[model samples]
Target: MLDTFQVAKARHTLGLRQAGEAFKHVISESDFNEAYNEIRTWSGYAPTPLLQLPALAQSTNVEKIFYKHEGSRFGLGSFKALGGAYAAANVIREKISTRVGHDISISKITSPEYADLAAKITLVTATDGNHGRSVAWGARRLGSPCRIYIHAEVSSSRAQAMRDLGAEVIRVMGDYDASVAATRREAQAYGWTIVSDTSWTGYIDIPRQVMAGYGVMAREICETMKTPPSHVFLQGGVGGLAAAVAAYFRQAWRDASPHVVVVEPELAPCLFESAENGKATQTKIVTETLMAGLSCGEPSQLAWHILAEEASDFLTIPESLVGPAVRLMARPLAGDTAIEAGESGIAGLAGFVTSALQAKLREKIQITEASRILLIGSEGITDPEIYTNILDEN
Candidate 1:
């Protein structure tokens, strides 16, 4: 286990470096703040309600369960839009600044100007589904050319969604990690800027930007609550979202901050494995789970650093439990109060339910009656056929 002093020291160093790097690239807090404010204004939607799930709370032996539903954001049906668009905008802004020798804000860059700029640049990334769609959307919105590479396992519906958003989609003949490799190689060859969330050596800025964009969600959560959550269960992919939430919450609440639990699918528990190993590591596990979002073979370097220091615990759930949790979420929490949640969204809830280390999890952290618990419903009803099939099977 990492000592508190070490964690604090590391976080301070990382924070300073991240802030400096972000500013140098013109992707400062002001950039994220500006994008978030604009999104709030132009998007005809409010922050999704922080809903209480009494039944879920009871089942998990917690006093309360608060679900932060992201289903309603811009009707895109997922939370990917937040980070995806922010990163895309940052990339465009930087490209413009490099050519014109001055910063160009997203709002001020007209469609024709953006199109001319975008036509000169190519936005590249790999995804299971949501992230690619989000990048495609951002590229289209900025009038940039985009090329998204996805694994063969990605569903037809998701691939079509990227195409609908005007991205040139390619189906890589392997899993998620392989697609990342393929995308990276392609980006290197063609000089396209790769805005991927998963980071490796010599490639960090775009992924860090992605995480910084995700920090807006944490800020929203803090502002929405009177007394913030006592524990936050965040699902881990390449660990971008989990790291973002954990880092921001740790900064915001100091020692009184929530116990953050990073949850992963047992089949591909890359973040959990890295946390246990006390360093960033990768594995060659085949992921055959429905929670495609959590099927990452490796953790992002920036994400690993944050989780290694600050995350309270890491938990992995078996494939068997995911379906049941998805069904349970669809059922009315109390009476006539059903919450719509996708399979990926319910993974955290499943982790809480299946964990044998429940006592250890709570003991290492803190929770009480007044302590709210926040779980992100990251996606909503995206794969209705799969969701319906899971429900019917259950």
Candidate 2:
């Protein structure tokens, strides 16, 4: 598929010295490992696989391509499952300490002894889809009540999943960024604890935990990937997942951090715009796009702190490329198993392939035949109807 969106690009760090300093100041391996250890105790905790796509590599003219398939990151069907739930758990732990007048062990938060304490707290958030489900799932796991606010454009399938998980759902009037605002207002009014993955001023810790939870996925990628990739392309929403991936890789690879490229919807390229402006910037107009998760109109402060300095490139892609990317992942050219990736799930691959195909883009992003590419397959078919429609379209 031909890409209609022009890539907005930048190289933040002058060298490994600057990149390592930026990454160290933001997050560390211990931050991610704490979450990973806690996540290991979850009922369905299992490492998501890092699958090699040689045919994809050959097609893109790269030496190798490794896709960390996160479709089955727990049964929630997206990497968001790792984040919101873990943050909810952490929030509950803090509440538990407040209730008991002392620090409590992390494992005992969900214990039968503290079940009533956990139930006393209510967690809330706004989402396009995956994050809300993960928050609801987290609340469900800790026996806490959850409520989610979503914008008008959110698909019914995603809303229904949240409802199915026993979360109260509210529909707002605008787009995802609007729903986040709505969630903030409603949270303040009701005194509900907002366990969001995105961060703002005076609201960094919970999101820090949330991103740290996502770090588990990054840690797994590093531990499993034998040959470190030359480039790590990640899809950006509020930048939580992308930053987590970038941070871990930056730490693990040390002075040899991969060329990190952040991808987002052209209609909602807040990160791309932020990188270009050299500061966090909000989108003037929020618009519809096929990649719901990437349809945010603002950048997260927490994410910006990590991404602005560490990320080497940023790309905003058109909706037209999404359908073909999904189709490409669904049918592998070689004997590799077909990946059941959704529209948002394939954004990294979409951006990577788009850049690799064009000589200018390849040169601009510093891609060549010797480069080893890594694209995260972020979600599975979370929305069956949209998945089927797009899959059938292309």
Candidate 3:
């Protein structure tokens, strides 16, 4: 059995390997400009609001606290759309170009002549909930098929949402990791290209494309802020979202970038252990947490690399604090500024709060009133019953 230190070392090494490979793409300033411009061209909705959490800031000792509110993302109530849609577009464009022996951008590939090509293309992925929905939405818009493999634990509402978007939803028994395996198997069997955000061996491109899409979020946040926060707390599952933000910030501000902290549930601290050990490692124990989105057992190789290189630290929070963080956000504050954040969405703030409440964390991190913190509310009301009814029960 690998010791904790050994596990972390393994993760760090794996992260380095993946980062070296991802750097090949390099995502130049022009790539970001192209991605942002292309994303605007394929838009279905307005940009999500970036709101200041004045109440939360005042409640905490931190000097500033901001929330990148993705709750309103394309009416899907999650930021997954940014990645999922871009992956679909990338795949569609690639397929069309391969057939016609010429390059076709997302804009040019949507014409009537390519209608048959779109119908033949299918996007496949595995998700706890949000990412799959975003892919399904994109597929529907692009006139393609989508197959979403979801763990059994995912709520009916979420599955139905994907189905509503015309995705063929497959319920896989077991956990999120198992669902990913199931999706991979089906994708291979059917020759359907997988557009997963997580990367394994021989499956790097689509995931990288997905990460590129997520870069839009960081770009938006940086552009919107007058003076970006000194620290950002990002929730981590397989670390795709955290990695995307970290990589973009690493490039956007270079060495002057804010401290990028990846927050994970203590139950599944693969990235945390990976960061500590220096190579990618998987947790032997299965995770059981209210934040389903953060219940990944293994770190994606691509995301692992980005976090290892860019993130300043990894913070692990216990499962119990997830609920309190949700409640705290929902409570009316400063008259009319209550935040209705989902469990996974509030995990970053919860980690911060837990750190503040812990003497060791406070002393070690030097967290003080001068610290400026940023948290991402990645989803809103995904599981309203858990956030609402459970909080009411408490």
Candidate 4:
């Protein structure tokens, strides 16, 4: 099966430091517990599957392969179901509590008692797709008005999905970074609370909450696994998902945690650029890739702080392998479960496969037959039209 695909090259950078106490303030056990406790109480909350791919492992020459499939996550088809919605809930809860002159329980924040207050608080964010849908769904659930901003390349289906969830969808003229800026400006002008997954200077709190929400997924993975994996290849989109999962593994397993490898599309590799420059650097997205959700130009500052300290490696995959990765997952090797993964979801898988096939990159990242690997399947068929097109291609 491995012989069917060509060995794709990847650019890798070793991490700055081992996971430690430094970035705990950004995301901690307490934060994860809080998010888990609240998020688990949601109407449709459940841990997504952790799939074992012995066929993939055998093909890649690894001891084992575990994929945390987020396709069924809250029926949203992406791992982003955790982050944005939970952050939106927090925003609504906090604002309502401030108005009521006392702290309100997250449990009761969505009760009938807070309906009017929630209605007054409009939640806003800019997303490539998944995050905006989560925020919009949360806003609708909590009785808050929501506004979602999308970039020029964001699909009509994704924008309409947010609209279906009651978000007022706005299409910005430029790329994802421009949409993010548009959200900032509009939020300030209209006094809307921004529930962004990515963080900037003064915007750490909500993003922190978002990442903590993501910890529920990590916790679920740990709870389900008999043993921790040796390596985890996480997809990087503003580094929130990678940082959250990496941070959780580091905290949970400490010194024995899996080596974190952040994977991004070569076209929009902000975290890769940041690793190269030794800082939270921004890349200008001159062209977008098929992996739409990972098309982020700027790294989240808070996420970078954690990724810098916790992640062991960073890799950028060329656009050529993304479709193949998706197709492979959908039509897997013998005995492997068929996973309907989206382009963004396949970044980690693409990185892992490429690294496994390329000897130099494999050794550099320390992949061997004895190594157990974990990959986060971050999304599913997020956009049906785009997904169909990819599958239909030769």
- Candidate achieving the largest lDDT: 4
lDDT for model 2: 0.84
Candidate 3 regions exceeding 4 Å error are 1-30, 285-287
Encode model 4's per-residue lDDT on 188-251: one tens digit a residue.
9989899999999988999999999999999999999878899999999899998998888878
Per-residue lDDT for 282-351 in model 3, tens only? 9854646778788888998988766767776677877666656777777735632577788879778776
For model 1, give the 10-residue run with minimal summed lDDT: 7-16
The TM-scores of all predictions, comma-separated, are 0.87, 0.94, 0.90, 0.98
Kindly indicate the candidate among 1 and 3 with the higher lDDT: 3
User: For model 4, where is the 10-residue window of minimal lDDT?
Assistant: 1-10
- Whichever of 2 and 3 has more TM-score, that candidate is 2
lDDT of model 2 at position 23: 66
**Candidate 1: lDDT of 253?**
71
Order the candidate numbers by TM-score, best to worst.
4, 2, 3, 1
58-111 per-residue lDDT for model 2 (tens digits): 877899988888889889889999999899988988999999999996777768
Q: How far in Å is the alpha carbon of 275 misplaced in model 1?
A: 1.2
TM-score, cand. 4: 0.98
Best by TM-score: 4
